[model samples]
Target: MRRAISRLKPLWLVPILLGALLGVLGVLDVVPDFVAAVPPPVIVTAIALGVVLFAVHPRAEAHQPHRMAAPVRGRWAALNTPGQQLPSHGSRFLGQYAAVDILRPTTPATPAKLRKAWRNSTPQEYPSFGEAVYAMAPGVVTATWSRSRDHRARNTWQSLVFMLVLEGSLRSVAGRAALLGNHVIVRHADGTAAVYAHLRRGGVAVQKGQQVGVGNQLGEVGNTGNSSEPHLHVHLMDRANPNAAAGLKMTWTDITRSEEIEPSLAEIAKQPEPNAVLSMPRNGEIFEA
Candidate 1:
C-alpha cells in the first residue's frame, strides 16, 4: 500500500485537478464564452487524460546502497535515517526515502541542555551550525542554492506547532528552494546524484558545474528551509532533479565509532563494534567518521 502511494507523483495532480475544474464549469455553464463553446470531445479528452494520469503510477526505482565517505566529521547524531525506517523522512516524495538528518550534540550530554534546546535556542547555538559540510563522493556540482535565510529554531513547542500549521504549508507551496534552503546537488560519474540540503545562507563554497572530489567542502549546516533546528540533510537520488528522481540507498564507508543517545538525553551508551562500512545511523545514534 505504501509503495503504491509512493508511486503517485505530485505532478499527476495537475491533470486531475484541471479535469475536475473544467467538468464543474461545463456542468454549471459558468465558464467563459470560449470555454463553454468548446466541443464535448475536448472536455472528454481532458477528463480522459486525467484518468490516464491517475492510473499510470511511476515506478519508485531502488538501487543497491552506495558506499561513500561520511559528509561530516566528529560526533553527530543521526535522525530520520533509513536504518530507522523506510521512507526515512516520512515520505517517498522528493526522493527523500533514504535521507538522513545529522546534528552535533554538546559534549557530556545533559538533560538540562536538551530541555533548554527544546524550550528555545538560536541556530548558531547548536554545535552543528557553521560546521563545514563535505561532499561524500567525487562529482560535478550540478546545482546550488544559497538565498534562503536561516530562521530561528522551531524546537520550542509553540514554534513547532506554528511550523506544522503554517510555516510548513507556506514552504511547501513556495516549492523546493524554499523548503531546502541552501543546497547543493552533485552528480557522480555513475549517474547517481548526491543532495546536501539545509545549508547556511552565504555558506555555499562551490559553484554549479565545478568538479569536486570526495570530502570537498560544500557548505555549512543551518536551520533553514523546512528544518526545525540546524542540521545537515543528506541523501542520494537517481538524478539531479529530485522531483523526477528516485532515492538510492547509501552507507557511510568510514565510521570509526557509534553510540546511542538515550531518550532522556541523559546518557550516551556505546553501541556494538563499529563497522568500517556503516549503514545509515538510526535516529538518536551518534557516530564519529
Candidate 2:
C-alpha cells in the first residue's frame, strides 16, 4: 500500500480522487444542491492537475539544462531539478513543484557509512553533510527563517518511509515553514530570486537585508525540513513566494562525475575532470566542484 501510494504521488492522484468523490456525492444526494453546484470547480481542478501531472516534462529530450557555475565548493548530488529530472516536470501554481533538491551523496557503501546504512550515526558525520552553502549570484536577502529543529537523518529506506509520513502530517499543520526548514531567499538583480532551503538549525549566516554575491557563504547544510538526509536545496524563481513563483533554469560551473560507490577524499580532490565539463548530470551521477 505504501509503495502504491508513493508511485501514485507523481501522478497526483489525491486531488483527482477528491474531485471524483465530490462528483459522487453530488449525484448520490449526499450533499445539497448548493454544494453540488461547486462540482465545476472540482472538475476544473482535476483537469488542471491532470495536465500538471502528465503533460509537462522539463527534462524531455527536446529540452536542455541551462548551465551555470557550481554553487557549492565540494562534492554534491544533483538529483531532482526541473532542468534535470521528471520529478519536477512542470511549471504550475507556484515554484514549489519546480525546485531542485541538492545534496552530497553519502551512502551505506561509503567509508563514512562504515558499511552500515544506520547505526546511530548523525548526518553531521559525513564530510559533505555540513558543508558550507554558497551564493550562486549577487542578490539581496529577502527572507530568512532559522528555528526548525534538525531531525535525525533517515539513513535507511525503511526509516525514510517513516520520515515521509511524519513530515507529511506535520507539514499540513506547520505550513510552508515545515517543508522548508531554516531557509534564506535572495532576489537577484536579473529579476530572478534564488532560495536556499533546509539549512542547519540557526545555521543562517546572513541578515534579511544583507547583500550577497556569488560564492558568498549563506549557511551550512543540515538535516532539516522535508529532507531524509543532510542536503542543500536551491532553486530559482520569478517570485519570492514559492507558492506563486515561476521556476527558472539551472546550470553549474566546473564539475567531475563518477559512479564510485565510495569516493575517497583524494579522488574527490581531482575534480573538474576535463571530460565532465559543462554537463547536466543525470540522476545518481556523482559530481565534484
State residue 259's C-alpha deviation in candidate 2, in Å.
6.4
Local distance difference test, each candidate: 0.75, 0.62
Superposing all C-alpha atoms, what RMSD in Å does each candidate have to the true structure?
6.5, 8.7
State every prediction's TM-score relative to the real structure: 0.75, 0.64
The TM-score leader among the candidates is 1
Q: Pick the candidate with the highest lDDT.
A: 1
Write the residue-wise lDDT of candidate 2 on 1-289 in tens digits. 3223222333564565565676688688696677556657666877577545633322212234445556688666655544344334333323444456666666564434223465435766655566888888888999888988887666665565666677555453345568778889988887677888888987789989999988899998877777766777777666566544556656675767664423422332233323231355644456787
Model 1, global lDDT:
0.75
Q: Write the per-residue lDDT of candidate 1 for residues 1-289, one digit (tens) a residue.
A: 4334434545555665666677688698778887667787887776676555544322355456889999998888877777666667766556777788888865453222334343667777777889999999999999999999988777666777888899886675356788888999999998989999999999999999999999999999987899988889998887777766677789988986455573433342233223211466766776887
lDDT score, candidate 1, position 89 = 74
Candidate 1 lDDT trough over 10 residues, lowest sum: 268-277
